[model samples]
Target: MRRPLLSEALLDTIRSRAGGYDASNTFPHEDLADLTAAGYLRAFVPVERGGAGLTLREVAREQMRLAAAAPATALAVNMHLVVTGLAAIQADRGETALDFVLDDAARGEVYAFGNSEAGNDLVMFDSRTRAEPQADGSYRYTGTKIFTSLSPVWTRLATFGRDDTDPDAPLLVHAVVARDAEGIEVLDDWDVLGMRATQSCTTVLTGVRAPADRVHRRLPAGPSGDLFMFSLFAAFEILLAAVYTGIGRRAVELGVAASHRRTSMKNGGRTYAQDPDIRWKVAEAAIVQDGVEIQVESLARDVDELVDHGPLWFPKLVGIKVRAVEGARYVVDQALRVSGGASYGSSGELGRLYRDVLAGIFHPSDEESAHATVANAYLGPLER
Candidate 1:
């Protein structure tokens, strides 16, 4: 694997500040600045665009490494990476629609994903936001978006909405809106149980404007079969799974360390590492974490190699995400068990990890959606 851009010292600083950030309900500005200085934000852009030119698979490995240092920071950075990755994926496939993103990244502009909305079950297929077309060929987007990661620092937000102005082209309009532009408001309300350092606040768009030139795609509303959708799903799911896998790996390591340190009074001063039950629990967590790691690497490699699985691709991608998330939860639980009651303190590292792992359940390709996608792949569509 290629060397990671984030150094151990930088990662340690980020990790050290994570608890304070979470406690204060603040964003990790220092961590972001360090990462930006490292040019980690442009890792997905082509080398010609002044980036590291890393492939999706390589970037996934890097993300996993970063997550092990600080999961919330990794999760927040994942949004920017996903948007840039989508642009890279399309550009590599001969699409000029997202060239502006590459150009902007090369110029050191930060991007954020503002695609999520409350109660939008169709996900990328449709939208609850309204996209009103202008006479000058621009668009006005109006809606509220939830979980807007990097809310405080993004220079541009890649957003989407529905445009039913043209009957034949009832479209899902995609565009990039400037962060400081009119009609955009980032509410300071991001308190949560975990991943608090992300500061994914609620963003209200009264009528944010995107110039005609900034608009990229206008797919027919509802479950698009376009390259944009493919890139979005593939990059988002794989990168997300990588984060959880890293969390699981960290949890296993912590469990082992705790076992080696704690002594078993009942066993005549023997350490917990010599206790059968503690050893079993640690082994169980390791086994599950290893499985998730392998799956993350495999699917990421498939994406980079363009290995065609056809209809099975979506199921496989979603399946890997679900497996990674659920596996992380289980592994973390077992680790806590092996580490004993000391891990239960809310301020402890293990305690924070438990909270961070729970946020995985809320990410895209959720448990229900993943299972449905897999079922549809093997059993065909349900009868209407």
Candidate 2:
């Protein structure tokens, strides 16, 4: 077998601290620090640039491994990896738009995805923020972004907005801003039911400036078949799915352990592990997790190998995300049923897994969007 990309000891340490961080509702700063020091943050960067240069598929599998140890930590780190992964995709294809991202990653600058909005159904196709263009080719972005993971530690934030000042009305402007730049405020309001350790606080961008060099791409409003867009969607969805799938894997493991440790009084000292119902639940959860694992691995590999799905890629990508997330939910729920009341406690590992899996529902191309994408792919766009 090949050696794991991350050290087992490191993951064990992260797993040990996950509960404490989650209980305190604090960001996994220690995990981030350790990962940064160990260069896991640069896994997607080129080896020539002082990074591991892991392929998208390798990184996705590693994320699944990391998430099994610490869900919130892996989820938070996914934001940084997503940015770097997208840059790596572009660099691999000979694009220069993400050169600055590569340079910054080599210099140990952690990146965060800050493009999500509170009420914007447009997702990445459009933005609610304002990008006021400057004479020097820079832009000042003013808006609010929700779910800014790694909010406390990220050095650079990749953001986007609408440039309505142009007569065209909806230019999708993209830029990367420094976290400490003026007009940037990180609100300490990340109180949530699950994935609490991510500290994905709300960010208020009040005229935050992105200089000309950092401003990467500008496109017309609505989705496009751009390579960069594909990279972003692919990386984001695959890694995000990997995280929840890991949660499901962990839940299944916990359920199995619980079943073995728990004795059934009705069976005269027999373990729950011997109970037919418990066994069935465990098997169901295991099957769901296995299905997601396969989908995540296959899709990630296809992306790395540049398999031409053409117009079908969007539906396929979104389909994996939806399947992985929903499959995880099923696995966790079944695992909880197998483990019984012990998992009901908020501090229990299974309970934490339950809450963490719920967050997968909120990621991009959510149930409605994903279904619409698939429906449109088969039925064609709807008429007004």
Candidate 3:
């Protein structure tokens, strides 16, 4: 049998720390340190680059396991993985532009996603941030990015902004900026209902410069069929699905255990596990969870194997993400129901899972967007 990416002892340690991190609404600093020491941050970098050299599918599985233990930590680390995974994928296709990302990550640099902007529905295609081209080829970015995960200790931020220097030809300039770069501000505004340990704060860039060497792609704005875009969607959606799937798996496990542990007053003091209604609910949750797990694994494997779904790629990616997140949400809800009032306590694991799972709904390729993508792929663009 293959060695596990995250050993049981390490998982237990991380899991034990999760509640404290959540309760304090603090970043999982210790969890990050442990994962980094284990070389988990470099999972997608090439072996030659001093990394574990794990495949996307392998990393996806590991992420699922990690998320089950400490979801906020996993979700925060997902940003770094997505950046390295994109670089690794590009390198596999003989593109060396993003090799620096892989190199930096392998050398202990933490990368975070800083592309999400308020009111910008055209994610990855356009940006509310302005990227002004400099004479020396570097670009100065100025904008506010919301949900900037790994905000506390990221060394680098993978972000983008629109460069509209020419009125007729606007471009989306993708680049990575050092966290300590001038004019960059991290706001402590990430107190949300769930995923509290992530501390995904707001970032304000006031003419923060991304040096020329770090500027990777400058593509036409408004959704192009670019490989970079495809890589981003693939890495992001698949890994996100993995995290939520792990939550679902944990929910099912908790629900099962809760059923066996809780005794019913009306059923001759028998455990809830012996109740027909509880059994049916658990079975339903498990069934949905099983399907989500299969979908996440299958899609991730296809990405690793370089399966060419072409036009179907976006639809498939979004489909799995939507399914995994929504499925996990349903499973968590069912698990809460199965566990009853005790599970509703703030300190309850089920309650934490319920809150954390809700953050999934806000991730990209949301239900409305996913349905539109699938519809456009199968039915063609609606009369537009």
Local accuracy of candidate 3 as per-residue lDDT tens digits, 30-97? 99989988989989988888999998889989999999998899999999999999888778777899
The local distance difference test score of each candidate is: 0.90, 0.91, 0.92
Best by lDDT: 3
- Clash list (residue pairs), candidate 2: none
Provide the lDDT at 147 for model 2.
Answer: 97
* Residue-level lDDT tens digits of model 1 in 1-384: 667787888888888988888778788999999999998999998888799899888888888888887899999999999999888888777888998998898888888899899999878888999999999989999999999999989999999999999878789999999988899999999889999988899999989999999988989987655888888899899999999888898899899999999998899999999999888888888889998898899998888887888888889989999999999999999989988898999988889999999999999889888888899889997999
Ranking by lDDT: 3, 2, 1
As a TM-score, model 2 comes out at: 0.98
Off by over 4 Å in 3: none
* Model 1 poorest ten-residue lDDT run: 222-231
After aligning candidate 3 to the native by TM-score, how far in Å is the CA of 287 from where it should be? 0.7
Ten-residue segment with the worst summed lDDT in candidate 2? 1-10
Full-model lDDT, candidate 2: 0.91
Query: Between candidates 1 and 3, which one is better according to TM-score?
Result: 3
TM-scores of all candidate predictions against the true structure: 0.98, 0.98, 0.99
CA RMSD of all predictions: 1.2, 1.1, 0.9
